[model samples]
Target: MSNVSVCFSWQIFTMESCVLIILVAMPGVWGGAWGVTFGDLCALKGTSVVMNCSYDYPSGYSVTNVGWSRPHYAAASGKWRLFFLSRLPTPPVHFEYVGDYNGNCNLKIHDVQRTDEGNYYFSFVTTLDRYTSTTPARLSVKELTAIVRPSTVAEGDDVSLTCVLGCPARTAVVWFRDGQRVLKPVFQARREDAGRYYCAVLGQETVRSASVVLNVQYAPKNVTLSVSPPRGVVQGSSVAFACASDANPPVTPTAYSLYKDGQFVSAGQSHTVLGVQPSHSGLYRCQAWNNVSWRGVDLMNSTEIRLDVQYGPTYISVSLEPQHAVEGSRVNLTCSAVANPAADNYTWWHKRTDSASSSPGPMLWAGSGRVLTLPAVEASHAGLYVCRARNSVGEMSSAEMLLTMSRGKRGSQPHLIIAGVGGFLSVTLVIALLWYRKQRTHAERKPAVFGSGLGVRGSSSPATGDQLDAVYANVGTSQWSPPLATAAQDAASRSQRSARHEHELPTSDEAEVTYSTVTIQPRNPSFPPRTNNSRAPQKCGIQCLTLMAVDIHGRKRDTLV
Candidate 1:
């Protein structure tokens, strides 16, 4: 084993002779073909690190010792100390030698401190000469730190994030947000980029910097207004409107304002309308703002909503098809109304003709819409009808409509009576025609009579001239018998009686008398003889029968004719 002294005045010591000597960098102290190679290293504080070093010395000479040390003093001072040496059995505190003393000069430092930041040097002594690296391996002890520019930045603004090491080193810097790596170091900040962030060196990835929180403030966005009761907003109702805004920092109630038809109505996060009226119905909007922008520049307004106020089912009216209905026919009754919220229910009522009250009677039917139907109309259905309509707002009743049976249908009884009379008259006419037919048949069965036989009433044969003279009597008498009126009436009566007697049937002797056996007939001698051109006297409604009789004298005699 060998050891190096601190100064030139110190004695040299050996493994057996106990000789010690000072080793220093002089103009010709390095041996032939001597060189050193090393790379820069980055180490984290409070952790362990290894500084690897290799050196080339005279090839033929046997190797003796190797050691590592940090260059703490100036190069001109020529004062240096060994923190770790392979020749020594034990290293100094916080320093250890874990490499071969033949050529390897690797040194490990435990619990590295920030003050240990410097260049490290490696030295080796051969049997011929001693060598120390001129270009020492540079070592850097860094405490990673995340630097965020403009600690409080507005959202959508460009920002710079950097990972800083206490000392210079040729290592990459990586950034992390929360526990995940942030892909970009410099980018526009957003509200979502607001968590804890840290940084680490490439080699010391587990040793990270202190966390830094990014505060991204922004103006309000996506402002919206909501209503408590969406439908059936009517009078005497309580309605509430709520405003919501999307902002990094919660929007304060003071930032919200409610407007009704472009006019300011209320403030705060919500507005309430208690016992609302028609005046409250209008277009509504809400606006939100924050301190991030100028006044009236970034204020966000919500979509407008139209509020309608419902009132009533006003002016209800009922209509009837075929204003006048007929019995046993179909009738349609329609009930309609005008309302804010259209009618939701309908009811129908009926009143009888005999009912005295003006109001309608019991409910006939209930429905959900406007139309009502009566399948078969009857006389009982002919009366006043009323309709009622109701909705969420209010209820209303329609005016009465009178239903009556048709006029032609009401006089059915008279029509039936006329039909019965016509049928009776037809039956009477048929009976009279049957009796007339029977009388005509009897008349056709009788035998026809021949002229100039014997004049008879209801006799089968006609009268002969001699028989007519014997049967007839002269009624136009010239002898005075009575007053003029009595004689006239008596003459008429005798004339009709004589005509009737001429038709009377005679006995066998009279029936056998012939014109050849009779004497010459003559007119009455007292009266002038009749001339051929003389017209027969006319009686009112009686047929005149002229009769001639022969006397037992050669002179002609005349009888009543």
Candidate 2:
């Protein structure tokens, strides 16, 4: 009973509630007329808390022992864990009983942790009954922590800052930059934003995390080029070059390269040339690069400088449009030379050759141009020619070229006349012979079919003392005919009859009725020439025919009427 009185009195003192108020408020809610009092408590982690309590017992009930237990929901079924028990010489290390044997109960807990959050109750043992406070004190513990996602990053990158706690309760998170409130949890980092950063819970301003500095790496920029002795460099003089750029984690010489006329020349931040030629006169440029992380992007800067050098002529050449020319033809000769300053003067020379002599002739002073022309060329123009080109730098001559006269048909009118006459005579002879052979073949193919002529179909007697009109008859004949006479005789007879027909001047109808005969001369010596056995003696030839007209006196008119 003494131990119970000591622990219960401590709980009552710490609670600080008046016992008379509870008794008047609730008359029989305590059931056996015993009551308990406990107020809620709130504290921070790593701090201490005091649970003030008070209680009452009915009359004639004796107390024996007092104990404090924690109701935890961690197990399957809720259970109470005894943390402080009276009758022990001293309270547990984390708990201390600080009240007397009266009804004032106060529980002190030191070095509070996050796990110390729950409801606590005080129980006391009496000789007749056991009493425990139905109303427990609710204790809450809070802790503040900070977390940074991806603490290190490059320039122009995004990061997040968060304030966290061991409990699931939501709270406002505040961020700080260089010990100043930023009021935001997300940070869009740039080169200028590289500094110390931290975070804290809003209500617990005193709690914070260790500061972390952000590292921002960036590529090279603001590239520039410089040259020593900026002007007036001779053709064979020396010169120096330098390149530079600005970047974080300062760019090294190995990251720089030099170019001449857009072509890679060397690798370095600086370069020197000992003997610069005119070929080196062009656009010179330098580039700086920093491709860390190589995002498949072009991260580089460049600058350029133009270099001019003075030089003399280096190459000379001569050309001719028509390398071979004929007599009385136009010709052109040109000389060309490559120099820093172009050539302005030119001269021509000739080398003549003959069947008896050859020599380098006098120089022809042409105009101050690159080309020379000879308009009306002749045999005298046949020679070896050369050209000389001159400028401020130097003078050079071209190789010699030999020009000669053309060998083609020129002047022979007599030979042309003779050839023309000979061709005409040969054609005439061929035509005469072809005509003779064609006549002989025609005579052999037509062996002259013999047929008696048919007189007029109806004959009418002429009237007395009347002038009779002449009648013309057209007779049709086949291609076959009878033989007339020997070839020689026929030819003689044809001549005679042609002469007679010319004298007589027969009409068209009578002349068209001329006889055609083809004779086959027998090669046997005994064969004799055939004779005409008709009633009248007719001209027996291929071109002769007898035509007559009879009157009422039966007189034959042998001539055409």
Candidate 3:
């Protein structure tokens, strides 16, 4: 027993010398045979921590208790008091002593929190003595925080950011913006850089700082003008216009100005026009402005938009082609009007005018479409014409226009009159000729009367005697002869008497007549008149006997017996 005691004391002395050398090498660290592996440690909040520890003693010593302890401030005593924890039956849910009594003395803390930051000490009890570590294991619970030099800045201005830990320490830091890694923490501010930003330790990506927004001021961009009731703007209706823009500091309502056809109209974010008219239609635009500026200008203009106001047809008129139309010619009547959304329907009306009809005729449906075409115009097509133009809004009728059909070809009126006169003269001539012929025929049918006388002459030749015999036979009554002297004297007297009475003679008809007395003697006393009873002498003394009667009009008729 005395020898064992001597050996134990020798071992204790040697261990003490070794511990003294370790303490000189690493200052502020637990350097005895039983000590923690680290002097200080840092951990993020809500993370687990493990402390490696070990212990040794003299060969004859036996371990009785093993535990950990920390210092807490006691406000009542104005001093730091020690709080102890031991693994009695089991460790707490938040803490565990995984080491055994032989050598290992590892302590684990689950779900480390901000309150867990402090110094920790390990102690053990042996059958000989109780020992505690002189150096403590300091714990630092940290959280990541991001700091910006200026949270808000204008575009093109400089900005800086920093990642700060709750406790000051030398550690690498990384930055992120909107879940994307950032290469640098300092940059020139731009519109694209305005977003949430945070930071984390280099190797501990799970730790992050709260998000902060960076506002970047900029001039208005993408300015645009919008019209309410986008289409189909009609006259006498309300119209609305609104201006919008993209800006950091929104433009004020009073900062908008409206323009039409490059002329200033109104000032406001929105403009309203009541009872819109066709004159109000034009190109419209809006100007937007704010406190921000780009280059040298501050105002921005939107793209021009067209506002069209619709209206019904007006100033209706009809136009006719070939103003002087002739029969069998084509005619066209075109309807025209000034309107928005051009007229879709056209109607033609006709009112006939004629000599037989005194008053104007009722309107008739002539045709439809912009142009009324007369394929083959006739005299019946002559009338007063009108055209009506219509659209979705309203309709209007044109003034009356006259459509006249010309006789024959144009400029032929004088010729027609001359032809009519010639025809009248021809008919008069025909009637005169017929009447003259009838009067002449009636006069020719009348007979005239005159007194008669007979004469006979005898020839000495034998042929003459035969002729006398034939003449007696032609008389068919009796052969009676008178002495030559007596016959000649008697004939002469008769001739004279007939001549004197010829002027005093009258006709049974009421027409004047001329009487003539003819004496017949044989051409040669040998020639005699042949009689049908004598077997008709081969030749007669006279070839023909003609008596002519004359009227006072100088017309004549001849008789042969």
Candidate 4:
């Protein structure tokens, strides 16, 4: 066999730089040729790799066989030994020798795995001699992996993600978050950005990095407060309040707080108040917080709510418009109470006290509503008043109030009696004065003729003395006027004179006589003296005068004057 020389050169490109390798054959091997093959090639897992190789020996030498080999550990020799890949009883299905014995020694591997990484050699045998490449090409299997600058970050912070591979190759990278494609690997972190992320080489869809989880921390949001019983919360009933919020680090049970009327009440996610009352009714709110912070504040508050506690009427009482009630006067009674839900119904009751009994009478329904009005209060209205207030829950009655009525305006009996007596005395004095004046005028006209007994003035006999006495007796002394009393005394004096004349005069020549006694009373100083001409015979004060005569034979005659 002739001495031959073999030489080989190849280039390797990587992400950082490119490398060139040349293998020099033994000095005796001259005019031998070897095809350039890749040096130290890199490939991602689950991908395919190809190694280019060819050989040329003396032109007369015919190619017999070609194969590939890899270094392996030999237990018997206790040293490393070469294992022919094609000589194995069952060759690996992933490996294929595409090159033929004519000098092409290319080898291909599919679905590269970490275990397939190692140095590889190509060998060929001809009719005269056999040769193998001295410098072997190395195969490095790498896997795609995702790298994050910060796995956990606060919202609004900047984040960076990268797809890394040990292999040296410039390939376009694609990023994904929760199975959704992302345009950029670096972005501002937000609440939505928190999720699983991965990357892959642009063309290698099957080559994907392990998933990485992103966590975004932020302050509590959407804080809310809820009541177990939203409506119809009455006194003595239990009530519950629940607080909730959305946050990266969920609010702790102890971080919840309750407030009433802007004042803090208690702490806890759920707060319960037993035996609620009207005093508990006010504006309410809840607050929540977590370790996360935003805008210089770590706590958040919910919108205000109203907690209304229902209750029955309390402190019921009645008020009077006019404190004193009198007959025929206007009066008003008003009812009032303190309650959560205002009292809707009002009732007024009355117990009369005007009865003879000292105790109050039975209570009777007086009126309904907040106010009871009496247009004209009377005696019958005098009584004890009570007001009742009612609501949906219960009812209450006010204390009884006594009402007294006074008499209306009217004249007293004593004053009327005095007025009547005074009027009667004034009428009596006026009549007495007029009568006295008339009597005085009549007496002045007659001038009190001193004629004592019956005188015959016109042949008419005057009334006998006995007849005159009988007439005088008919005039009542109680009814006698002041002037008549004096006339009565004068008649008595004239009777004595008539008796004397009867004794002295003869009985044979009987004569008729008419006599009248006229008495004049002193005139009152309030009246002027009357004139004689005013007292003519036609105007005689005496009502009448008469005279009569009798003959010797018992004959009688009549006369008028």
Candidate 5:
């Protein structure tokens, strides 16, 4: 058996090793090049590495089919796939040449990548390996592409450019940035990846290539932008805008860079107010860049935005219904902040507490702030009212206006106490008079009916009966006392008692009463006692009763002496 082999160090480019050949004669001992060495190669990730294999077969042992594959490292097997004469090379397999079955075979990689490292085998349909099989060919790879770095990037401004490598990491890849060899990463990413980014590649055995271009994408991209006051930004006035961008390095470390009209005005600032108004205004924009990208992107773009200065509503107004209303009268109030373009809106809040309070508390006037149409004004609405006006730019308030709600004119006057009393007295008097008249008539109309043996009589005399009851009952009896009975013959001594009473009744206007005995002493003796007994003696209301004899005044006699 005879074999040829070459050896070299892992990472270093070394001179070719001396070849050695050993010859041996024995049965089943196959002789050929046991080891064909392919040195390590540098290439970018996601690219292919090829191991070209060629061989001469003995005349008696004709060739069958040839195949290439990574039998070991199952995980890397896909990355190191197979190329055969009969089938298309599997995934991770490059392009295959079918003509290899008769003798010629070449493997081509469509897209190369990292991780496709390890041993590869070639096979022929034979008795040994179902015809033929080779040990393996060892190949190594070195990364060829350059690293990229970016420096400080603003939210809306492009950060400076920085890069590690700009060249393809193959054939001794060369790095160049801004037209210079860059051994280390640059500080900032360039726009267009910069006409600046490129690399020159040298051939493994032939001529070198001119620098190639590298297009990079970095963090923080830009979006729409707008302003609250779109007219023209003024000095000492707040200006606002919106910014957005897409980035992997994170837009967090980014800051806003504001350019006024065209000149750099501020940085790391969004809500900006140029305290001092500049004289000009024009084009404006910003870009974002970071070490994450080889080229910078825009975080927020500058739309058409200008700044202008203006004033807001000054004095406000408040009106009360029925301009001349009385206290506690319902007052409709309209408090408005009159200014340019009116107000944005109005909000009304009472100076005091509301229904949530514990007492008869105050409440906010209802309506859209400016007009508070109090359905009904109460005493509570009597106070100072303040009108406030505000815009995106500023806010102002009006002087307080005093609002007085009155309880209108008195509904009706209070009735007099005397009138109330007089009414009650008149009612009482009427009742009294009616009762008196009724009693007098009733007594006069009644026919006397003596009990048992007594008689009944109707006399026209003013006092047919004792007139006592007429005068007494005139005032209406408080207590009606029955007259003392004279003679009640129907009963006992009571009959005489009743009789005396009965005879004592007055016959004429003046009644002659014969007491047991009596004598009269006139105020003037000249005027003798009236001899006409029926002539109604005495004066008014006098009563006369006819009797047997009378003795003298103040005395009762047994006979008419």
Candidate 6:
């Protein structure tokens, strides 16, 4: 034992009789019996447990003499100390904080302690047959009795505390909440539910109960995620979805993911958008998370999208003007094809010629397949040309054009001018020759007088032939001039010569100056007629005839004719 003790003799106490006399235990040679009747009581921190104690007394003992003590087992002097006691008016000083002695002297310490286990002694006297009965009390103080409440409960359900009581013989059950006595059904304290609770009982010395954690679990039913703009959104637009459930906490940061075209677009804020172009169209779904412990769940099962793009025309053409071209002239070949989309490039083709074959054949210029243009004229340039235009969308070609050209003539203009001048001079010379010929024709006489008018001379007829010598002598050199003035002029041009015929044989007739001496024509047939010319002869065979007359100077005429 750990405490001081006092001894009391029990032979003086009677069972049935009692008086109000005090009998204190004195210092004794041997200490009072202190034993631990109930083993150490056990309990959790927030609950309660109990220990049991009891004693016997004879009749006729004074009831006021009972004294209960709980002593420390570590105390020297061999007894347990009185931490709790019970008595009547004016009981022992050690019984101040102990239990009452009026009826059942049971001890109940709220929130029992582990160090409370020790020896407990009861010293009392009771009145029965009117004798003074003194007795020694034996007490064994132990740890508080205890139990453990069940630790868990599901939410929205009845909660029960499975209280396991230690020291079953001495432990009693009492309900306490926040250090106050709470009335409940026999051993069970159930109120729809509670978070943490305790059980207490009064027994020998201590009160204790069990402490347990009441945990609850529940799931929110009908959980769902709402998608804003729920109607499948247009491609390239936006959508939102939020996961909502009836849970204890609704504002937990959850994940909302969306998928499309075999790709994940977003993982939060529910909606997924596929905006405007055709490529953006696809199927979509979403997964969400919240204040629940399950893995990500699909908020949306399936969705679809269709996006369309509208466009205008393409491949444009512009009509070229001037459908005909000359080989020498530079043709303005404008080939234009127009559409909503501009044409990117242009090509030119030739319309086949060769009508006889009935099959179109390419001309040389046409085979060039270039914009129809000819810098200079050539026979090969004659062909038809067409321009083709194209863009990404489509292609178009322009109408063909025919090119014609005249080959230039080859001549020297300077030679023509010289020839024209020489012809004019030749015509003037011929006109002058004709005028001179006409003038000469007018001067000639008629054909009846051809070869007439020779000079005639007459001399006085001297006796024929007798006076011939004398007559010839007397007619000395009287000359006859013939009409040969032009011939005479020809001889005079050589030298100054006398116009005289040879006078050798003309002595007789020549001295007489006789014109009859000239030979007359004997009809002139034997003369060969001057070898007649075949061409049309000149009409005036004898041209410019002149007559010779004698000029007597202002005197009587001498008849010489």
Residues 1-561, candidate 6: write the lDDT tens digits: 211112222333442222222231234422233221223334333333333444444433334544454444334656633332342222243223343443334344443334434444444433421111122233223333223334443344444443445443544666554555545523332223444456655442134554443444333334455555655343345555454444322324444455666587765545434444335444555444434442233232333342222212223333433444333544455555544245565666655465466766753323223244445545555556666665554566666666555454312345557777888888988888988888646533211111122233443332222221121111112333333343334333322221132232345433322222122222334532212122223222222222222223311111111
Per-residue alpha-carbon lDDT of model 2 for 352-431, expressed as tens digits? Answer: 66657544566554434678787746777777777777766567777776777675532235656888899999999999
Model with the higher lDDT, candidate 1 or 5: 1
Q: How accurate is candidate 2 locally (lDDT)?
A: 0.61
lDDT of the candidates, in the order given? 0.66, 0.61, 0.71, 0.71, 0.43, 0.39
TM-score of every candidate: 0.46, 0.36, 0.58, 0.58, 0.28, 0.26
Give one digit per residue, the lDDT tens place, for model 5 in 241-260: 54445554545424656566
lDDT of 3 by residue, 218-302 (tens): 8898999999878889999999999999988999999999999999999999999999999999999999999899887899999
Q: Supply the TM-score for candidate 3.
A: 0.58
lDDT score, candidate 4, position 65 = 67
Q: In candidate 5, how many clashes are counted?
A: 74
The RMSD (Cα, Å) of candidate 1 is 15.3
Writing each residue's lDDT as its tens digit, candidate 1 over 1-561 gives 133333222123244322212321344544357767778877877567888766676667666866676544435667754443333333356777777755676778776777766777776666655656776787788677788986788887887898777655555878888888898988988878888888876666777788998888887878899998987788888999999988867789988999999999888999888998877889999998887763337787899988988978878888888676766667788998987778888888776665566665665653445777877777677777788888887898888888877745433456679988999999999999999999868754533222222333356654344453453343233333334334345445655554454456344323322221122233344443332233454222222222333323322212222
Minimum summed lDDT over a 10-residue window in model 6 is located at: 552-561
292: Cα error in model 3, Å:
1.7
| Cα misplacement distance, residue 349 of candidate 1 (Å) | 1.2
